[model samples]
Target: MLPYHDAALPVADRVTDLLGRMTPAEKAGLLCHAPVAVAPDGGLVDEPRTLLPTAPTTHAVRDLHLRCLTLMAPVAAGPLARWHNEVQALAARSMLGIPVLVSSDPRHSANENPLTSVPSGGCSRWPEPLGFGALGDADLVRDFARVIRAEYTAVGIRMALHPMADLASEPRWCRTAGTFGADPDVVGALAGAYVAGLQGDDLGPDAVASMVKHWPGAGPQAGGEDAHFASGKDQVYPAGRFDLHLSRFRPSLHAGVAAVMPYYGRPVGVDGLAGVGFAFDPKVVAGLLRRDEGYDGLVCTDFGVLTDATLADGTVWPARAWGVEHLDRVDRAALLLDAGVDQFGGEWCPEVVTDLVAAGRVAQGRVDESVRRVLTLLFRLGLFENPYVDEGNAVATVGRADFVAAGEAAQRRSMVLLANDGVLPLAEGIRLYVEGVDRATAERYTTVVDHPEDADVALVRLDAPYEPRQRLPEAFFHQGRLDLPDDRREHLCALAATVPTVVDLFLDRPAVIPELAGHAAALLADFGAADEAVLDVVFGRARPEGRLPFELPRSMAAVEAHPEDLPGGTRDPVFPLGHSVEALDWRPRTSEPQKG
Candidate 1:
């Protein structure tokens, strides 16, 4: 047996042996981490399936020698396990027999954004990350992560592209639902627990390597815009709180996170730093993350930074090269390598690395340095010994009854009680008028009425306000104004006048809701709970233990006036951070507020 194949040896020794034996082409492939789509039957898609360009899976594995890949399709556990084994079998036929390292974005949440998270797809569903912040319990967050690790590893996924360490300081940022909260202290603790739960003290076959993302924080985008589009490229520090943003990452780094992902936003007006994307900024990646912070783990860039392409509908999807868009592809790739990024996400260009080394633009030593880090992680995961997963085991382990029950319990616990006027616990047997809630679910609790005027109480479910952009993919991100629409606001107030109304607001982002606060008899905020879970909290079957993770501003004007980089800066919040009222029947255990 080869030295690298012997599991008894030290991981470092195995990595060193594998790195020395790999050819330049193989090393180049290690730098490219491309996306792969799964067919309906769980086979690899040979044809183009999505807007993002991807080579056929077989060709990417055999011809390009690519070993790292991300899943683009949301498939069930059994199918995904079958596909994983197929990929590993093909990879074993390669000259060096390197096992593929599969990774995925958060797939267990109810928020199904195509760019960020996938649908549950038969996996145990849970609330958004904001809910975890609301609960403010590190132990619960770690327990949730343990379930994630188990399900992911069952399907042969070794890397988790999650636990976004970026704080949700800016309210209008589209990705706020993915973060823990605005407070660095709270987010840091939860992120550390998430990393520890996934990787434990060491990463092995049973553990999934956690990749804490958007290094230096992507939350403070100027004007509350996201970094995904050109108009939102600038990450401004108006409060001069750049260092404060970095505080959220300290605990994750301290926990020995397996990977770090630099964001697409470029820092504006920072001292002694270039105004460029974090992945292309040597000062940020090499100096701040590597040298200053003393992190030596894998550094991967966020998706599609090296090249631009067109969508199937002919929309120009610009490369997120940001400040360096003027530079050509080769120069951009070279600059990113020099910036200390070890892997290129959403990129399929292994030739760029090979050609750069061949032309002497990038030294062989530099290539070897990155190759070593990638191989080290692969070895630590024990992929060489056992890369395939049992389909039956995956089917049984994923979405197990216990796991589903735990997730449902968390969803109920994460609902924050914002207001109560002696009208909650829903008074046993009151006639109900429901909107946006399923009739069957409401009927189980009490009588369901057709109109608010005929009912004793009204129960309405409302989504937090967002203005949709007029672009295809950009519109997918919930951005723009946070205030409720005039029509919806007026309609709600009119209904409340007819009967006492109980509102359940799904807070993907903090909403400006002074009118709702004044009109609704009771208000509860949920991150991503099911209809049953919401009812469980409303009917007092389960008590809401969540605190507000972010401030709910009284007006959009207040949100605009607050510094994007600073937390707790809203002038007149309807509900401040950590604010939550108890149910009418809830007995107080202590005078002091609960903290995470």
Candidate 2:
């Protein structure tokens, strides 16, 4: 006997009534998630046998009501329609008829990838958030959000875990591409517009719920790196820098974001809270977010991260920090619940939660609290109103021509001019040499050259190292002890020696900018969409108006002086923050060909 029936009632009260009737096993079921098809059969993680156990095997609607299910993998365009239909059918078979809440990581772009998760069926692959900030156009930000919302809603995805509001304070952070910029005001305004575009005029039915993430902030990690592993878990905020980071979140919260996600890093010294990550700390989650901030929305933990874990990639690791490995999964769940985490993102430990209740290690009341919050979020998202999709519109709505147009516009706006030595806006018909341009993107520009010597104006593109999968070819992820590897450095140096190179480094994180002080003609760096828009700026089709969003450290040593000690940590960037050189007028020194 669940509590309330009318969907129109307040979400908290409705959830409260429903939580009172659930059995311990049913409450535990809400905490577990099964992985579905990550991609069509033949791609990475291709074993169907590996995936079968994760598929939704049975619906426990009647006996013990199941609340929600997060999809494991992304479904293909052709099969997505069928998949949604099947998922809806599963819900119908359940006792409570609760529709599954399908969600996903950022799928609107190709940059962040293992490509193991589901691909968005319909949506233009917009430039990453850093690119959006470069545009500095609020309307485009709104449009990008709307396009993502349309694609997600069309495909039966009710919630979007996106519009990462973290600022790019630490350039070495691997996830810098996902954030807006270094300034909190800029990130806040753009992020809010993105939220508005996703949710629409009405907060309830018209818009998809936006989950603003890594609450408080995850930007200031010890080293500009992810906090997931032990090496980069400490977060230090001196003299209340938290207010600067909180600037972005405040707007999203006011705009009625549906949920918040805390990061994995532990914080040091704030209001008697000694050292604790927000995910496992009641002071951070309940005290700050829920109590002080007045955010009534659901709070979920980051995926596959727990305070303690007995398993490591399916193998056991020795007992680690915080007594995590020693504590069982149930105890971990209890800690999360008490700390005010409403839902476990991509966690697969339902049996442990069940065991805890049976053993009386965890109270039934606490389980009910988390379950209520999860259900409340689902209901607020309007999942129950109509959970099935039309299927026919899935492909048509996603990444359509209009959406691509919007993405292109955003890409153009984000281009910032780093340097121009009167050689830019090359005279019409001058041969242009470009390295690192993809075939499709190159076609938009002049012909790409095999060697820089053959062309009149040489352009090259570079990016910070990002290994898409957890297991990358050893050559890419690192070299010796520092971030950039030897082979990549050698390759770039070879190209710089060949011509008066115009280098465009995709400045997501500050990498070791090779000593091209005398080697290259001009250097231009940008945070987003470096490949696509660099061509436009090169030929004077578009003006380079962007400025460095954050400080570019000279070397890894300089980065170490800051809170998040990054590789290439030196304070002297080849070009400092806000450094941009305008295109200069040029005259050929001599028309005569010189000996190569």
Report the number of the highest-lDDT candidate: 1
Candidate 2 weakest ten by summed lDDT: 472-481
Candidate 2 on 170-269: residue-level lDDT in tens?
6666667677867566788988898888888776654687788888788876655456555556776653576677666888888888778888777765
Summarize candidate 1's per-residue lDDT along 239-312 as a digit string, tens digits.
99999888799999999999999999999989988999999989999999999999999999999998886776
TM-score of 1: 0.97
The true-versus-predicted C-alpha distance at residue 202 of model 2, in Å, is: 3.1
Candidate 2 ranges with C-alpha deviation above 4 Å = 1-21, 32-35, 38-67, 72-74, 115-122, 238-240, 269-271, 307-325, 439-444, 447-449, 465-498, 526-532, 565-572, 582-596
Model 1 misplaced stretches (Cα beyond 4 Å): 584-596
Global CA lDDT computed for model 2:
0.63
State, as a TM-score between 0 and 1, how close model 2 is to the true structure: 0.84
